[model samples]
Target: MAADDERGRGVLTAADRAYLRGDSEYGSVQAERNARARIRDRIYDALRDFELLVEGLDDRDLDLVFEKRVGEDDGTEAFDALVSTLAFLYRGVGRTDLDFETVLREGVNLAEASEDRGATVDFDVTYHALDADHLLSKLDDDESLSLTEIAYLYESADVTPDELAAYFEDARAPDIEDGRVQSNVTDY
Candidate 1:
C-alpha cells in the first residue's frame, strides 16, 4: 500500500507524466525556443543602443570629421575608410547585403545639410532596425544562422552573453502539452 501511494504521488507530477511517455524531446524543443528568444532579444537591444549612439552625435562634430582630411589630400573623405572597414567586418560575418559606403554617403549628406542649416540632424536608424528584424524573422523561421554571424551580431549590438544569462536567470520552465510547449514569457 505504501509503494502504491508513492507511485500515485509521483504519477501526479508533470515530469512523471513526461517520463512515463518517454517524451524527453519536448525538453529539447523548449530549450531551443528559449535560446532563440534570448538571441532575438539581444539583437533588438543592440540595434536600439546603436541607434541611440548614432542619434546623439552632434552635427558640428560630424561636420568637423567630414571636413578633416586624412593622408594629406583625401578630398573630403567623411568616414569613408571607417565605413569601409565596418562593411568589411559585416561581410565577414555573413551580412553580404549591407553597403556601408551607401550609408556613409547618406550620413554625410545629412550632416552637410544640417551644417548648412545650422540645425542638428536626426540620424536615421531604419536600416539597422530592419536588419535586426530580419535576423529575428530568420530565427522564427528556423533558419540556421552561422556562429560567426551570431557572434558578429552580438558584438555589433554590444550584447554580452552574461547579460543574456542574467536576463533569463529568473525565467521559469515552460509547460508542455501534447508535445507543444507554452512559453513562460507570456505568463508575466
Candidate 2:
C-alpha cells in the first residue's frame, strides 16, 4: 500500500502564526496567549498519554513498525508524526522506564477513548518542537520557542525554560560572512 499523503504537517492557524510573529497591537493579547496555551497544553497531554502506549518492547525495531503502519491504507500522517515524536523522545532522552503490560492495557483504553471522541488528539504540530532537528535549529539560531515547543521540550527532553537560554551556549556559532582566513597562519 502507498503511504498516506502528509496533511496538517507544520501547519498552524492564521491567528497562531500572527501571535507567534508578535502581531498583537489591538487584539486581546491575553486572550490569544490563553488560547495558544490551551492548545499547547492539550497537545502536550496527548503526547504524554501516547508515550504511555509505547512504554515498553525493548529491542524491537520500532522503525519497522513505523514503516509498516505508514504503508497501511488507513494510516494517516498524524500516526507518523506521533510515532516519530515518541521515538525521538524515547531514543534521544534514553528513557528506560518500560512496562509492556501497562502499555498494552492503557494503549487499548486510550485508543477507545480517542475513537469515541472522534480523534481528540491533534498531531499537526508534531514537528513543532518534538523533532530534534527543529528543536536544535531553534536553539542554534537563538530563537524564541512557542508555547507548544516549550511544552514538548519539557515533557520529552526534560528541558526547562530556564535552561533554553543556555542549551547551545557551548556549540559553535553559525558561520558568518566576515571574509577572514584562518586566525593562526602557519609560516613554512
Candidate 3:
C-alpha cells in the first residue's frame, strides 16, 4: 500500500497535465520549446537515416526516391520540407538542387508560428556548401533568390553582398521587388 501510494503520487495529476498542456504563459513557452526540440531531434534522425539510405543509390534512383517520398500529401509541411532539404543536400557534390531552400523557408514558417520557434533550428550551417559562388552564378543565370534566403544568409551565415562579391566577380545584390522589405531584412 505504501509503494502503491508513492507510485500514484509520482503520476501527473489533472492540474499537472493541464500545466504541461500550456495553461499559462510560462507553460506555453516551455511546451513550445519542448515540442520544437522534439521536432528538431526527429528531423536530425530522419536526415541521418536518409543519408544512409541515399549513400548506396545512384543519382537517378535518389531522384526517384526523393520525388516519391516528398510528393506524398499525407505528410505535414515540415516533414516534406525536411525530406526535400535532405534530397537537395544529397543531389550533388558540387551541384545542388535549389530544393534545399525549403529548410530555411520551413524555419521561417515555424518562426512565424512563434518567434521563439526559430531559435530551435539552425538551418544555415546545414548547407555550408552552398557558398556565394553557387548563389551568385544562379543569380547571374537569371534564377532569383527569395528575400527569406537573402535574410537568412545575411543574418545567420554573415553573408553580405560585399562578401559574395569578393568571392565571385560581378556579384551584385538581387533587386528587391516592389520595394517591399521583409521583417528579417533590416538593412534593406
Candidate 4:
C-alpha cells in the first residue's frame, strides 16, 4: 500500500535482473539476452502447436473472447497485464478476408466507454509492474492473506491500472522530495 514498499523489487532472479540492468562488460547481459531469446523461441514453438486455434482470428471471435475473459475476471492486475498485452497484439491483427476491422473498432469503443464511466473491475490480488513479486511476497507474510485471498483482493478491487497510472502520471521516481513515492494514488 505504500510507495516505499514497492520500488526496485522484481519477480526476476538476481542474475536476470543484473542482465536486464545491462552491466554486461563480462557478457552477462548478452547471456541474459540469449536466455530471453530462447524463451521467446520456445513460446513461438508452443504457439505453433496451437496455431490453428490461436492464429488469424479477429476481435469478433478471438479478441472478443479474450476481453470477455478479462472483464469477467475483474481487476486481476498482473493477469490483466498479460491480457492487455495480448489485446494489444490482437489490435495489431489487420483486416483479413474472413475478418474485418469492425470487431476491433467496436471492442476499442466498448473499452473506452467503460473506462470513461469509471466502471470498476475488482481484483483479488494486484500489483504494479515494478513491485509485483515483492508485493506478492509482502502479501504472503500477512497472516490473514492467502494466495486465494490475495487473488481475491486482486479480483475484487474496482481500480484499474490506468487509474493507478494516472494518479501518479505527473510524478517521476526521482522527484520525491518527501516521504513515500512522489505520487498520489487518490488524485483524480
Candidate 5:
C-alpha cells in the first residue's frame, strides 16, 4: 500500500515546512506544533480575563499624582526631580516595607538603561496616590492581577505630574530652535 500523503495536512503542513526541511521527523514536528498551539490557547484564555478586568475599571481609578519642584538653585535639582517623580509613583501602591529611596534608584537605573538602548520612554504620572487596600481588595475579589503584576504597575508609575504634563505638552508643541515655550511680554 502507498504511504499516506500527509502533506498539506496535520503536522506536515507548510507551517512546519522549515523544520521538516532541516531533517526533523514527522512525529517531532507534530509534537512541537501541538505544544505551541496549547501554549497559545492558554495565553489567549489568560488575556481574556485580563481584558475583562481592565474594562471594569473607571478612568479616574487609574489616575495618580506626583510633585515637581521648579526653579531650584541646587545643582542636583534635575536629579531630585527625577527621584521625586519615581518616589511619588511608587508611593502607597508599592511595597510598604521597601525604602522609597530604593524605588527611586531603580527608576533611575531603568530610565538610564532605556536611554542606552536608544528607546524613547514616555510616562504619565497621576496626581492621585495609590490606595493599597483598594488595590488588594480588588485583586482578592477579582483575581485579575497577581501580586507581581500590581507591584510592577505601581513601580512604573514613578513619574511626576508636572513632568508628565510638560512631556505631553512638549510632544504636541511645534519644534523651535531653543525648544523653549514661546511667551509674549505685555506692558501693564
Candidate 6:
C-alpha cells in the first residue's frame, strides 16, 4: 500500500476483481503461482484490516480471542490459539518436537537444517542463566574475561530478575535511574 514502487501487478483491490480474467494469464513477475500469491496477499490484507476495525464491537465475543490469558479467571481456560500458532510455525519452519515455551522464549536455530532428518537442521544451542558478572566477563579488558567461561555461561543461564535489577545499583550503568529497567523486567 505504500507509494514506493510502480511495479509488480500493483495492488489487487476487491473493486478491481471485476477486471480479473477467468483464463489463467501468467504475469511478468514470474508465473501463475507467483501471481496467485500476490493476489492472495491483497485479499488477506483487506480482510484482516476489516476484521480488526469492524468486527470487534462485542467484547464478549468468544470467537475473537487473541491472547492466551483470556478466560483464565478460574485458571483452567485453554490456550488453543497460542498452541496452534506455535505448532504451525514450528512445522512450517522445519522444526518438530520442540515445546512451545522453548520456541517462544529461546527460538530455534535453522542454519543447521540439513544436519539430521529428524531435526531439519543441526544446532548446538546453549541455554544459560545470565547475570552481570556473566556478561561483563565476556569483555576483553585485562579484566578481560575468559572466552571459555563466557561460552559456558551462555551454554546454561538466564539472568534472574533481581540480579538484573541490581545492575543499576552501581550508579554508572546504562539502564540507570534507580534500576527502572529492572522494574520493567520484573513486570514482564
Taking all chains together, each candidate's TM-score versus the true structure is 0.24, 0.25, 0.25, 0.26, 0.18, 0.19
Per-residue C-alpha lDDT of model 4 across residues 1-188, encoded as one tens digit per residue: 23223435433334444555574334587865777886557556654654454434554775566667445553544354575455545544432342324444554555556346433343242534434445445534642333333333233345333332333447443333232221212222
Clashes of 5: 6
Q: Please tell me which model should have the higher TM-score, number 4 or number 5.
A: 4
For all candidates, the clash counts are 0, 0, 0, 17, 6, 14
Over 1-188, each residue of candidate 3 has an lDDT whose tens digit, in order, gives 22223333223434343445565343487776875566557556765775465345566775565676445533444353575455545563235455444655764565455434444444454443545566666666867665445544544354564554343344344632222223323222
Best by lDDT: 3
lDDT tens readout by residue for model 1, 1-188: 22223333321344434443455333587875765565557555765665564678775665564454334333223234554456554564456565555655665676566456433335354433325446545556766444334433344455344432233336322222112111212221
- If candidate 3 were superposed on the true structure by all CA atoms, what would the RMSD be? 18.0
Q: Which predicted model would earn the best TM-score?
A: 4
Question: Once model 3 is optimally superposed onto the true structure by TM-score, how far is the C-alpha of residue 95 displaced, in angstroms?
Answer: 21
Quote the lDDT for 131 in model 2: 72
Candidate 3 runs further than 4 Å off: 1-27, 56-63, 66-188
Greater-TM-score candidate between 3 and 5 = 3
Error in Å for residue 46 of model 2: 2.0
Which scores greater on lDDT, model 1 or model 6? 1
Say which prediction, candidate 4 or candidate 6, comes out ahead on TM-score: 4
Ranking by TM-score: 4, 2, 3, 1, 6, 5
lDDT of 5 by residue, 1-188 (tens): 11223334532344444444563543687887885676557545654654454456443443321222233423244444455454545664364776555555655565465346433435454454555555545544654543233433333445323332232224322222222221210110
Task: Please write out the lDDT profile of model 2 over residues 1-188, one tens digit for every residue.
Answer: 11222333233444554556666332587976787886677666766665654555332455456556445534334443675566655553445576534444555666566446423332222432267567757767777665345435544455443454346344222211121111111110
Native-to-model Cα distance after best TM-score fit, residue 90 in candidate 4, in Å = 3.8
Residue 11 lDDT in candidate 3: 31
- Which pairs of residues have clashing backbones in candidate 1? none
